[model samples]
Target: MTRRISKTKQFIMMNPIIQFFKFIYLSLKVLVIVAGGHGGTR
Candidate 1:
Protein backbone atom coordinates (compact mmCIF):
# COMPACT_ATOMS: atom_id res chain seq x y z
CA MET A 1 0.00 0.00 0.00
CA THR A 2 2.75 2.42 0.81
CA ARG A 3 4.56 1.59 -2.44
CA ARG A 4 1.42 2.19 -4.41
CA ILE A 5 0.95 5.54 -2.71
CA SER A 6 4.49 6.58 -3.52
CA LYS A 7 4.07 5.47 -7.09
CA THR A 8 0.92 7.51 -7.44
CA LYS A 9 2.64 10.56 -6.03
CA GLN A 10 5.55 10.18 -8.42
CA PHE A 11 3.19 9.81 -11.33
CA ILE A 12 1.29 12.90 -10.31
CA MET A 13 4.49 14.89 -10.12
CA MET A 14 5.62 13.74 -13.54
CA ASN A 15 2.27 14.07 -15.24
CA PRO A 16 2.51 17.73 -16.12
CA ILE A 17 5.99 17.47 -17.57
CA ILE A 18 4.90 14.44 -19.56
CA GLN A 19 1.91 16.34 -20.88
CA PHE A 20 4.07 19.32 -21.81
CA PHE A 21 6.48 17.18 -23.77
CA LYS A 22 3.62 15.40 -25.49
CA PHE A 23 2.17 18.74 -26.53
CA ILE A 24 5.50 19.87 -27.93
CA TYR A 25 5.93 16.57 -29.77
CA LEU A 26 2.46 16.77 -31.28
CA SER A 27 2.95 20.38 -32.37
CA LEU A 28 6.29 19.56 -33.95
CA LYS A 29 4.72 16.66 -35.83
CA VAL A 30 1.97 18.93 -37.14
CA LEU A 31 4.42 21.59 -38.17
CA VAL A 32 6.50 19.07 -40.07
CA ILE A 33 3.47 17.71 -41.82
CA VAL A 34 2.28 21.18 -42.81
CA ALA A 35 5.72 22.14 -44.09
CA GLY A 36 5.94 18.97 -46.08
CA GLY A 37 2.58 19.56 -47.67
CA HIS A 38 3.45 23.13 -48.54
CA GLY A 39 6.76 22.09 -49.99
CA GLY A 40 5.08 19.46 -52.11
CA THR A 41 2.65 22.02 -53.52
CA ARG A 42 5.49 24.35 -54.40
Candidate 2:
Protein backbone atom coordinates (compact mmCIF):
# COMPACT_ATOMS: atom_id res chain seq x y z
CA MET A 1 0.00 0.00 0.00
CA THR A 2 2.78 2.40 0.88
CA ARG A 3 4.63 1.56 -2.31
CA ARG A 4 1.52 2.16 -4.33
CA ILE A 5 1.06 5.54 -2.68
CA SER A 6 4.64 6.52 -3.43
CA LYS A 7 4.28 5.38 -7.03
CA THR A 8 1.13 7.42 -7.41
CA LYS A 9 2.88 10.46 -6.00
CA GLN A 10 5.75 10.02 -8.42
CA PHE A 11 3.36 9.71 -11.32
CA ILE A 12 1.55 12.86 -10.24
CA MET A 13 4.84 14.72 -10.18
CA MET A 14 5.78 13.54 -13.64
CA ASN A 15 2.40 14.03 -15.23
CA PRO A 16 2.92 17.62 -16.30
CA ILE A 17 6.30 16.97 -17.89
CA ILE A 18 4.84 14.01 -19.72
CA GLN A 19 1.93 16.08 -20.92
CA PHE A 20 4.24 18.86 -22.11
CA PHE A 21 6.33 16.48 -24.16
CA LYS A 22 3.19 14.93 -25.59
CA PHE A 23 1.98 18.33 -26.65
CA ILE A 24 5.28 19.13 -28.32
CA TYR A 25 5.28 15.78 -30.09
CA LEU A 26 1.75 16.31 -31.36
CA SER A 27 2.58 19.79 -32.64
CA LEU A 28 5.63 18.52 -34.47
CA LYS A 29 3.57 15.77 -36.06
CA VAL A 30 1.01 18.29 -37.24
CA LEU A 31 3.70 20.56 -38.65
CA VAL A 32 5.25 17.68 -40.55
CA ILE A 33 1.92 16.63 -42.00
CA VAL A 34 1.14 20.16 -43.07
CA ALA A 35 4.51 20.58 -44.68
CA GLY A 36 4.13 17.31 -46.51
CA GLY A 37 0.72 18.29 -47.77
CA HIS A 38 1.96 21.65 -49.04
CA GLY A 39 4.96 20.09 -50.73
CA GLY A 40 2.82 17.46 -52.40
CA THR A 41 0.41 20.06 -53.71
CA ARG A 42 3.17 22.14 -55.22
Candidate 3:
Protein backbone atom coordinates (compact mmCIF):
# COMPACT_ATOMS: atom_id res chain seq x y z
CA MET A 1 0.00 0.00 0.00
CA THR A 2 2.73 2.47 0.86
CA ARG A 3 4.67 1.62 -2.29
CA ARG A 4 1.64 2.15 -4.44
CA ILE A 5 0.96 5.52 -2.81
CA SER A 6 4.56 6.60 -3.33
CA LYS A 7 4.46 5.60 -6.95
CA THR A 8 1.28 7.58 -7.46
CA LYS A 9 2.78 10.61 -5.79
CA GLN A 10 5.86 10.43 -7.98
CA PHE A 11 3.78 10.11 -11.08
CA ILE A 12 1.77 13.16 -10.11
CA MET A 13 4.87 15.19 -9.46
CA MET A 14 6.50 14.19 -12.73
CA ASN A 15 3.48 15.08 -14.84
CA PRO A 16 3.39 18.70 -13.65
CA ILE A 17 7.12 19.11 -14.14
CA ILE A 18 6.81 17.81 -17.67
CA GLN A 19 3.84 20.07 -18.33
CA PHE A 20 5.57 23.17 -16.97
CA PHE A 21 8.55 22.71 -19.26
CA LYS A 22 6.31 22.09 -22.21
CA PHE A 23 4.43 25.29 -21.48
CA ILE A 24 7.66 27.25 -21.24
CA TYR A 25 8.90 25.85 -24.52
CA LEU A 26 5.67 26.67 -26.30
CA SER A 27 5.61 30.21 -24.94
CA LEU A 28 9.20 30.83 -25.98
CA LYS A 29 8.52 29.50 -29.45
CA VAL A 30 5.56 31.84 -29.84
CA LEU A 31 7.53 34.82 -28.62
CA VAL A 32 10.36 34.12 -31.03
CA ILE A 33 7.99 33.86 -33.96
CA VAL A 34 6.28 37.10 -33.03
CA ALA A 35 9.55 38.90 -32.58
CA GLY A 36 10.84 37.65 -35.89
CA GLY A 37 7.82 38.99 -37.70
CA HIS A 38 7.99 42.45 -36.12
CA GLY A 39 11.76 42.74 -36.25
CA GLY A 40 11.94 43.04 -40.02
CA THR A 41 9.77 46.14 -40.35
CA ARG A 42 11.30 48.03 -37.44
Candidate 4:
Protein backbone atom coordinates (compact mmCIF):
# COMPACT_ATOMS: atom_id res chain seq x y z
CA MET A 1 0.00 0.00 0.00
CA THR A 2 2.84 2.33 0.85
CA ARG A 3 4.57 1.59 -2.42
CA ARG A 4 1.41 2.23 -4.33
CA ILE A 5 0.96 5.54 -2.60
CA SER A 6 4.52 6.55 -3.36
CA LYS A 7 4.06 5.64 -7.00
CA THR A 8 0.90 7.68 -7.19
CA LYS A 9 2.67 10.61 -5.58
CA GLN A 10 5.48 10.40 -8.04
CA PHE A 11 3.08 10.28 -10.92
CA ILE A 12 1.21 13.30 -9.61
CA MET A 13 4.46 15.23 -9.37
CA MET A 14 5.49 14.30 -12.88
CA ASN A 15 2.12 14.72 -14.56
CA PRO A 16 2.39 18.46 -15.16
CA ILE A 17 5.79 18.25 -16.79
CA ILE A 18 4.50 15.45 -18.94
CA GLN A 19 1.49 17.49 -19.93
CA PHE A 20 3.70 20.49 -20.75
CA PHE A 21 5.89 18.47 -23.04
CA LYS A 22 2.82 16.92 -24.63
CA PHE A 23 1.37 20.34 -25.27
CA ILE A 24 4.57 21.47 -26.95
CA TYR A 25 4.66 18.31 -29.01
CA LEU A 26 1.10 18.79 -30.17
CA SER A 27 1.73 22.41 -31.09
CA LEU A 28 4.77 21.48 -33.10
CA LYS A 29 2.85 18.77 -34.88
CA VAL A 30 0.06 21.15 -35.73
CA LEU A 31 2.50 23.73 -37.05
CA VAL A 32 4.16 21.16 -39.26
CA ILE A 33 0.87 19.96 -40.58
CA VAL A 34 -0.30 23.48 -41.35
CA ALA A 35 2.95 24.28 -43.15
CA GLY A 36 2.72 21.10 -45.15
CA GLY A 37 -0.87 21.79 -46.16
CA HIS A 38 -0.08 25.35 -47.18
CA GLY A 39 2.88 24.25 -49.22
CA GLY A 40 0.88 21.49 -50.83
CA THR A 41 -1.83 23.88 -51.89
CA ARG A 42 0.63 26.10 -53.72
Candidate 5:
Protein backbone atom coordinates (compact mmCIF):
# COMPACT_ATOMS: atom_id res chain seq x y z
CA MET A 1 0.00 0.00 0.00
CA THR A 2 2.85 2.36 0.85
CA ARG A 3 4.58 1.54 -2.42
CA ARG A 4 1.39 2.29 -4.31
CA ILE A 5 1.07 5.60 -2.57
CA SER A 6 4.65 6.54 -3.40
CA LYS A 7 4.19 5.51 -7.00
CA THR A 8 1.07 7.64 -7.26
CA LYS A 9 2.90 10.59 -5.72
CA GLN A 10 5.67 10.24 -8.26
CA PHE A 11 3.16 9.96 -11.05
CA ILE A 12 1.44 13.13 -9.90
CA MET A 13 4.75 14.97 -9.70
CA MET A 14 5.93 13.69 -13.08
CA ASN A 15 2.79 14.64 -14.99
CA PRO A 16 0.49 17.20 -13.47
CA ILE A 17 -1.71 17.06 -16.57
CA ILE A 18 -2.57 13.45 -15.78
CA GLN A 19 -3.53 14.52 -12.30
CA PHE A 20 -5.74 17.27 -13.69
CA PHE A 21 -7.47 14.85 -16.01
CA LYS A 22 -7.91 12.37 -13.18
CA PHE A 23 -9.49 15.05 -11.03
CA ILE A 24 -11.81 16.05 -13.84
CA TYR A 25 -12.78 12.44 -14.42
CA LEU A 26 -13.58 11.96 -10.75
CA SER A 27 -15.59 15.16 -10.67
CA LEU A 28 -17.57 14.11 -13.70
CA LYS A 29 -18.20 10.73 -12.10
CA VAL A 30 -19.51 12.37 -8.97
CA LEU A 31 -21.63 14.77 -10.99
CA VAL A 32 -23.11 11.92 -12.95
CA ILE A 33 -23.98 10.08 -9.75
CA VAL A 34 -25.51 13.20 -8.25
CA ALA A 35 -27.44 13.74 -11.48
CA GLY A 36 -28.87 10.21 -11.05
CA GLY A 37 -27.50 9.03 -14.35
CA HIS A 38 -25.54 5.93 -15.37
CA GLY A 39 -22.48 6.84 -13.42
CA GLY A 40 -21.53 3.27 -12.47
CA THR A 41 -21.67 0.01 -14.28
CA ARG A 42 -23.30 -1.83 -11.43
Candidate 6:
Protein backbone atom coordinates (compact mmCIF):
# COMPACT_ATOMS: atom_id res chain seq x y z
CA MET A 1 0.00 0.00 0.00
CA THR A 2 2.76 2.42 0.88
CA ARG A 3 4.54 1.60 -2.36
CA ARG A 4 1.40 2.33 -4.30
CA ILE A 5 1.06 5.73 -2.61
CA SER A 6 4.67 6.57 -3.35
CA LYS A 7 4.23 5.58 -6.97
CA THR A 8 1.23 7.83 -7.24
CA LYS A 9 3.19 10.69 -5.74
CA GLN A 10 6.04 10.11 -8.14
CA PHE A 11 3.64 10.10 -11.06
CA ILE A 12 2.18 13.41 -9.91
CA MET A 13 5.63 14.93 -9.56
CA MET A 14 6.66 13.77 -13.03
CA ASN A 15 3.64 15.27 -14.81
CA PRO A 16 4.74 18.86 -14.28
CA ILE A 17 8.28 18.16 -15.39
CA ILE A 18 6.90 16.76 -18.63
CA GLN A 19 4.64 19.79 -19.01
CA PHE A 20 7.50 22.19 -18.37
CA PHE A 21 9.61 20.55 -21.07
CA LYS A 22 6.68 20.69 -23.49
CA PHE A 23 6.28 24.40 -22.82
CA ILE A 24 9.96 25.00 -23.47
CA TYR A 25 9.83 23.03 -26.68
CA LEU A 26 6.82 24.99 -27.95
CA SER A 27 8.42 28.32 -27.08
CA LEU A 28 11.59 27.43 -28.90
CA LYS A 29 9.57 26.48 -32.00
CA VAL A 30 7.78 29.81 -31.90
CA LEU A 31 11.02 31.70 -31.48
CA VAL A 32 12.50 29.96 -34.48
CA ILE A 33 9.48 30.75 -36.61
CA VAL A 34 9.54 34.41 -35.61
CA ALA A 35 13.27 34.67 -36.14
CA GLY A 36 12.85 33.41 -39.68
CA GLY A 37 10.92 36.63 -40.50
CA HIS A 38 7.45 35.12 -40.42
CA GLY A 39 7.94 33.18 -43.61
CA GLY A 40 8.45 36.32 -45.63
CA THR A 41 11.52 34.96 -47.40
CA ARG A 42 9.97 31.58 -47.90
Clashing pairs in 5: none
lDDT of 5 by residue, 1-42 (tens): 246568768878679788788989999999988897555677
Cα lDDT of all candidates, in order?
0.79, 0.79, 0.78, 0.79, 0.81, 0.78
- Root-mean-square deviation per candidate: 7.2, 7.0, 9.3, 6.9, 5.9, 7.9
Q: Which regions of candidate 5 deviate over 4 angstroms?
A: 1-14, 37-42
Error of 6 at 30 (Å): 0.4
Q: What is the TM-score of each candidate against the true structure?
A: 0.49, 0.49, 0.49, 0.50, 0.50, 0.49
Best by lDDT: 5
1-42: candidate 4 lDDT, tens digit per residue: 246568777886579888798789889999999887643555
Which ranges in model 2 have alpha carbons more than 4 Å from their true place?
A: 1-14, 38-42
Worst 10 residues of 4 by lDDT: 1-10
Clashes of 4: 0
Task: List residue ranges in candidate 1 displaced over 4 A.
Answer: 1-14, 38-42
Q: Candidate 3, residues 1-42: lDDT per residue as tens digits? A: 246568676776679788798789989999999887753555
Residue pairs in steric clash, candidate 4?
none
Against the hidden true structure, what lDDT does model 1 obtain? Answer: 0.79
Each prediction's total of clashing residue pairs, residues at least 3 apart in sequence or on different chains, is 0, 0, 0, 0, 0, 0
Could you tell me which residue pairs clash in candidate 6? Answer: none
How good is model 6 by TM-score?
A: 0.49
